[model samples]
Target chain A: MTETVIQTRGLTKEFIRDEFHVVALDRVDIDIRKGEFVALMGPSGSGKSTLLHLIAAMDRPTDGEIRVLGQDLRGLSDREVSYWRNSHVGFIFQSFNLIPVLNAIENVELPLKLTTLTKKEQREHAATALKLVGLEERMRHLPRQLSGGQEQRVAIARAIVTDPDLILADEPTGNLDAASADEALNLLAKLNRDYGKTIVMVTHDPHAAGFATRVCHLEKGVLLESLQADGS
Target chain B: MMRISNFLPLVFKNSFRNRRRSILTVASLALSLCLLGLLMAMYEALFYGPDPTPAQAVRLVVRNKVSLAQPMPLSHEQKIRQVPGVEAVMLQQWFGGTYRDARDPNNFFARFAVQPQEVFSIFSEYSLPEAERQAFVRERTACVASRTLADKFGWKTGERITFVGDIFPVTVELKLAGIYDDPNQNEVLYFQWEYLRESLRPVFGGEMDMVSQFILKADSPESVPRISREVDEMFAVTPFQTKTESEQAFVLSFVSFLGNLKLFMLAIGGAVTFTILLVSANTLSMSVRERIREVGIMKTLGFTPGIILGTLLGEASLMSLTGGLIGCAFAWALCAMISSAPIPFAQLRGLALTPLITLICLSIAILIGLGSALLPALNASRRPILDSLGHSG
Candidate 1:
């Protein structure tokens, strides 16, 4: 066991839309040791995404403690949370979500900008990350010029360029074709197996969730089941 | 080093991507500079204009008490000399003239009758040799022509020029003597004052010694106002009154009649400055709108909002500064071309876009740039990460 990189206790998330209060997550306690591959599976609006956002420090939890590398996110300011997110966490979203203006290399180099690393060092890291994702040769191509899968690879490169310990992936293959989604899932699997990075991924697609070592099913703001032996 | 190096190409490409808009903006700045330059140049020409000053040292003009139109007694020439400021005395009448060749007379200009011997003494800036100046005094029919007037008639030194005098009700022909120009003086013309007096033999029974006006002088500008006041007081009790002022004040006083055109010029300058501000702001706003996604990405990457805002404002200032420099260069060229002109408000034209003026213009560009960029940058910087992250466009 490397360590317990992230720990959460009694987490709850509420969504209010048009004066309607909807409980997205209810008093859910989860613990995973470092180097864990945990998939959060649920249908749309099943609090999977909300739980991901809260744990990633992208949103403040209404109640309970969520800690990344032992830093409690409860009272952290926006800037503080942003700093923590930039340095400690990497994200792979369902959408490719790349800046159109920047090329693949520049997009990869984006998160590295937050580090105090030198420009040359940042570029080297970004290039290495793209190479790891097997897209080094496509560095200079803009998002428009790249395919959907390639853009997602670039996004993954950007997320990992900072070498963050925890990679939070939310429906990383939601926009990809089956072939491309297979490629993305394989990459994530390889990242978890080889690099020993802890990953907490949320997905509606069972095939996408198949890549994780364990899958947690959530229903109506409650954890329904935890299925282990899921290395599909 | 790469960060800085990369910024240049990126900024340059983006700034000029809308090529037509950028060029039109540059040209607009240039046109403003041109207009400003021409106005300043013409003003300089009319005031300390490039045309040489007329006889200032050796000769002086004696005028009546009340004004320029009145005549002064010829005997007063000796009395004027007795005054400490007066070195020599000459007589001149404004010879309002059309042209002898009215069929197609060239540009309109005026000529004056001058006391030749003392003309160069009183108008020391005039560059006539003492010999020619003396000859003009001795010869009753000799006249000194300005270059523009001489150029019109194809006249040369020692050649004769003729004019149909409107004031005297007769035709006047005078011998041309040594072309002249005075570096320190302004617009003027001169012929022998005695020639006019002698030429008037039929009208005043050779009593043309009664001079139309007199030119006064002092050793320095410091003495001018005092001597002017004293001279006026000397004729205070006489039937004729006197008015005296420095030549510059005399010339500038005429500017008042156009009814605060200087203020109008100031208003025009303000309007130009205001327009540049608006232009810069609009450009910045549009640029910000285009870069929303890029900004969002930057924020997610850990770039602080301050950095994003600074970068955008810096870009705006950079563009405006470049445009301002081109404008200043255009203004410099225009100023050089019209440094010498014959317009009435010469002081107001040929205005030098001095280093300070250039800085001011560029600074205005920068201020406008930053001012316009502030809001857009703020909007972009504070934009929620989610909105931009989710932005389809």
Candidate 2:
């Protein structure tokens, strides 16, 4: 059996708004194995992104336990948590959250700075990551100088440059056009298949979900069902 | 250990993220610091007058006990000279007069009726050629001008200068016998007290026998305070009582005429510091608030809270340090320029931004930078990553 990379038991998240208690995620239990591409599908405000954040340790669960890569997140200090996330997780956001001031190559080089890598080695690694995302020629351009597709590709390069064990992407193609969205989804699929990266992506588009090995549906903060993708 | 050096480039770039705002902020800091530096220099000048030379350190002045304008009887000079440590004594009087026009501040300088025979003996620091000294002593209708004063009025050794008196009723005339150099007393003209007395004798009916002040020197610096007290006590019961003090103390008493200047400078300095603090805080707050989303993005990229806080503080400090250096350099240049020109006021001649003042200004600037950004940086660092990522800005 492949090792379980992500495990949650009765995971819950709550928010208080204007003196009203709101449950963003309720009693969610899920397990993701190594090298699996899982797509979490839901309408807006359905807590899919909330669950992904919990797994990535970007947000804490209000109740229950979350264990990623055999380490219980609640047991770690904030500093240790940051080190863990940097070493083990790569996150891609919907808006292609590239630092506007940095050029494409510098953006990819951001995470490598946290390591002991020399400047030359960091540059070589970032270049390889960009080439993997098919953005090798656009490395010197600023985000404003790139198209939405190119910008998202640059963000993808930034995520994978660290060689993290798990990739968490939240609506990575929501802002891209049809062609760009297809290209981004294809890249995610290739990273999971060829690179053997365990990826958990949250998206509402069924077309994007079809590229994953397994699909899960979330509604009103509840995980309803999980099923294998027929073609994949 | 996380190295802040890794993020220095990011901090530098972020400092200039909004060029207009950054430039305006730096300009505001620079101007405020410049004004503050000048204020500190003024306080330094007034509170602590010029340092006395070895000659000046042993000299004392005797004036009327009640007020500086009141005259002391000339008879007191003999008793003062008889004191145990007294080396020499000279009769000195302020001759308030107009040269060309008293209305012009540029024409202002210290004009004194002094005992020419005894002046050099008492103020031994003044330097004059032996021939000029002989000429000055021989000719009773002769005066000596300081090198600075002669250069100001373009006066030569043989030129005759007349003073239209304001205190006495007669005009006095004298020839410039020589120019003397006294670095500590730059703007002054000293003439024979006997000539002034003769000019005033007809109006006062006699030798105008009262002196404005008597300047005396003690044999040693250590005995100056004792001699001052002894002189004042010797004339304690006389109708024209005397108040004696060292030259430095006399200069300080003159500065005290400006009211409680130390307290005033302190209040102004406090107000300026607070104002700059507020301005800096507002600027950093705005800059951080606008970058909330970006901070969250970095947090998501696994930057710790400490790193975030440090980076922002580093940016603020860099900006403020730049402003501080420019402001201090500007103040130093201004002081140098003013020192080159003639300062109408004697006490303000040596105004400058000392090294201590520069260090203090730079320290305040850095404190303002760090103090202003602390709260905003703390809040941004501690804010939840989810909310930061969800933020539109």
Candidate 2 per-residue lDDT over residues B151-206, each given as its tens digit: 88899999999989988887888899999998675788998888888888889888
Where is model 2 more than 4 Å wrong at Cα? B49-51, B345-347
Query: For model 1, what fraction of the real interface contacts is kept?
Result: 0.22
Cand. 1: chain B TM-score: 0.78
lDDT of 2 by residue, A1-232 (tens): 8999999999999999899998989999999999999999999989999999999999888998899999999989888888899899999999999999899999999988788787788899999999999999999999999999999999999999999999999999999999999999999999999999999999999999999999999998999898988743
Model 1 over residues A1-232: C-alpha lDDT tens digits?
A: 5677767788898878799999989887777678888899988888888888887776778888887788888978777877788888888878777866678988787776556678788789989999999997899999999999999999988888888888888899989999999998898888899998888999988888878888988987777787775334
* Whole-model lDDT, model 2: 0.89
RMSD of every candidate to native, in Å, equals 4.8, 1.9
lDDT tens readout by residue for model 1, B15-110: 665678767766665566555544444444444433323332223234564556677676655655567765445555688765655455334555
Clashing pairs in 2: none
Q: What is the DockQ of each candidate?
A: 0.31, 0.64
Highest TM-score: give the candidate number: 2
Residue A112 of model 1, lDDT score: 68
Q: What is the CAPRI rating of model 2's predicted complex?
A: medium
Looking at candidate 2, what is the lDDT of residue B227? Answer: 96
**iRMSD, all candidates:** 4.1, 1.5
